[model samples]
Target chain A: MRTKNQKIRDFVLSAISVIVLIALWCAVSTSKPDFFPTPMATIERLVKLFEKPIMKVSIWGHIFASLKRVLFAIGASIIIGVGLGLIMGWNKKVRAAIYPIIMTLRPIPPIAWIPLIILLFGVGEFPKVLLVFIGSVFPILLNTISAVSMVDDMYLKVGKVYKANTWQTLHHIVFPASMPTILAGIKIAISSGWMVVVAAEMLASKSGLGFLITRGRDSYDVALIMVAMILIGIVGAALSIVFSFIERRLCGWMSS
Target chain B: MASKDIKVQVNHLTKKFGDLLVLDDISFNINKGEFVCIVGPTGCGKTTFLNLLTRLIEPTSGEILIDGKPADPHVHNISFVFQEPSAFPWLTAQQNIEYGLKIKKKSSEEIKSQVDKIIGLLGLEKFRNAYPHEMSVSMEQRVVIGRAFALNPDLLLMDEPYGQMDIKMRYYLEDEVIRLWKATGSTVLFITHNLEEAVYLAERVLILSNKPAKIKAEKKVDLPRPRSVSDDKFVEIRKDITDMIKWW
Candidate 1:
């Protein structure tokens, strides 16, 4: 009962805060052109963005462009991370060779490699995707490795007692056992990837939400910039919600 | 050849971790369908002895022969229930019980019948589809026990499986284990530090010494089925065993 009441109370407070912020904006601004755009102006600008083309692409096109890069990079990183991390965690020979290289590269920030990335790959979708991949891959890879290595000894004993062969143990025991931690890593990777794509776009792209934000800045359209920022925040929130739903579905056994 | 009734022969078994001897030249024979308990002090390498039986780790310098030959996991159908919660968290009660049958490549029909029987026997019908995290600890352990018994193993080794539970749960699970053991008639090597637990479950109890564990004493529990703790013989035997061991 308390939790239910708390949830309702929190929702109400959040709505109130947003209303107050909007009211403050309207109160502070005049009908004439001003430094800060009111909520009404921001809404009008957002509606206009959907109605007409900006920078030769519709609003949906720009959103899709950003979404595509983040999704593609995150997807590729999950595949690579699972593959390499499992190999590293299981096979000693590959682990010895590949483990140190990853450890060395892991501490280096993905954004720091932007200059080199742009120099090597050129300012294109590939560079932005690569940046997001670098930003996201570590959490997934490291968590997968930890998950595999850290499987409880008791479970392995159970496997041995049940006469599970090497492959059977890996398939039935290790993989499913690694899932909860891997999902947690995926959650981290996704948010990190989303943040990286915007920065990557701001640095390189000619189109995207980040590019749209930069365009707003270049044109000195405060309402346009506000629209882009609001869109980024909303999309970020939506991505988080979607990922949480996926996590609950995949690791239902862990739900409590 | 040894008699057909003998399931396992541990001849002069010993294990060493570096120079320190853990188990010192212990030998025993478990009959084909006997329930035997190995009782020892805490940290007395009882689990180590169980490990040797399972062949999870190699003995430093001895052999454990089953069926008058080498005991290898691949050749024998062995199952275990550890003290810790070893139920696969990803699987439901029913699925966890079916795991071994699937690994042994039993037919779908065999798997279904065996799983259904065990679930019914354990009274887990209501929670058969529940995952490990959803059930109480005792219920989860029951699921683990069911998983082990589903295989109907030639040898079932349980290492202090009820040691972590409360007294009520411990007694309840022990009764459940005994019921399963009686039903399956499987050879069980149960290890425990609890004297009452050993007395309650085992047909015969083998008590081990402190470190470099050796069979210090062996007592046949002649009490009736579902023996009461307050019964004269049960209490006497429990007291006798307690007096024999220098647990600390």
Candidate 2:
């Protein structure tokens, strides 16, 4: 719907916003250079961080270590959450049985489970992944449940009038109908998963952005800590942008 | 009485919501290929009656037979156009039209041919790939109508399908339904509270009394196709149905 000129104008406006943000950061850090670390110093440290291996892994290595865990945890949670949510929402008896369990565990923060998780699963990749899963799965599952409930009774009646079997109704009517809401939940899960993964990595492990921040704290390298912070934000934003693109494509009927 | 020519039989049909009686001992017969309108006053359980016929809900008593057997959605090729916009929003116009066939496990070739015929019939070629949000309100309803008729159903139940449309759009859609009806020769039971709409479309008008509603009258419409509201006979039949409704 937009003309080429309008698109260019919008892009320029957003670019201006990012430049303003960096300029503000530079001004704020000039007063307390040692404590805050200047933007240029952080950028220099980031480039150097890529050159040398901190804890025997490059910047890419640390990034990938965190990325792999978040990806695995979120992917597994989405599958498990959607399946459970669909069944619980569709069948009243199942919902009644599972309702208390979700309510009981959902309030407890993901970080609080570290001790029990470590004891049960041991200190390894699985525990970190499990922590992220605990943090993200509730949002995904709750959203999916709401999504199932959101499907209009009128649409289901139409399916019934056509004599669609239970499987057909679930496949054609329920799943597609609920996708917009489910996608909303996944967005929340991704953000929450990042928060949990970083905390888990900081507490234990020798690699990842969180571990880098821990090492910076020990060595008092403000620039190194700032670099890790910037990377976490950039990657989190990039992941969000990617999923936002997917949501536009998947639920075009709603947004369009 | 049950007969080969009759496509639908309602036998002592009754419905209740807890202690409240909604429909009391109603019975009717619709001949094959008939376009029958069940007209009633507002809040007179018109929808509940249609729902019972479609078996969306069980009757407190009585049974409805389609082709000499108890009505079953699986056994009968049935379709519906309800007051609500019933087209699946996720599907494009063409996919929505082909939905019933897909569920019935009709081959892809058969589904395509059937959907193509409906697309042409409803003049939706321009919007075959368009989603519901991209269409005008009337256009969306047309897709719903097209979807229902694409089934080439044995019985089509319409519950005030044009209730939300403006007068102009309603007339346009009514004619389209008639055209589809004639082309397919499927039996239709259309429910509406509007006497003019009933007379405009039905071959026979079945009047319902106000709540604890029962069928009070059935008048043959006998007027020719594409009947106008300005015509004397058309007005007379509408008045006759109106008078029956008023007397109750």
State the local distance difference test value for candidate 1: 0.89
RMSD to native for every prediction?
2.7, 2.2
For model 2, the local distance difference test gives 0.91
Q: Candidate 1: where are CA atoms >4 Å away?
A: A23-35, A91-93, B222-224, B230-248
In candidate 1, what are the lDDT values of residues B1-248, reduced to their tens digit? 35788989899999999999999999988999899999888888888888888888899887988888899888898888888878999999999999999999999999999999899889899998899999888888889999999999989988888878999888888888888888888899999888888999999999899898998988889889998988999999998888888555
Write down the TM-score of model 1's second chain: 0.96
Give the Å error, residue A80, model 1.
1.0
lDDT of 2 by residue, A78-104 (tens): 999999999987888999999899999
Q: Which candidate leads in DockQ?
A: 1
Q: Give the true-contact fraction for every prediction, in order.
A: 0.87, 0.79
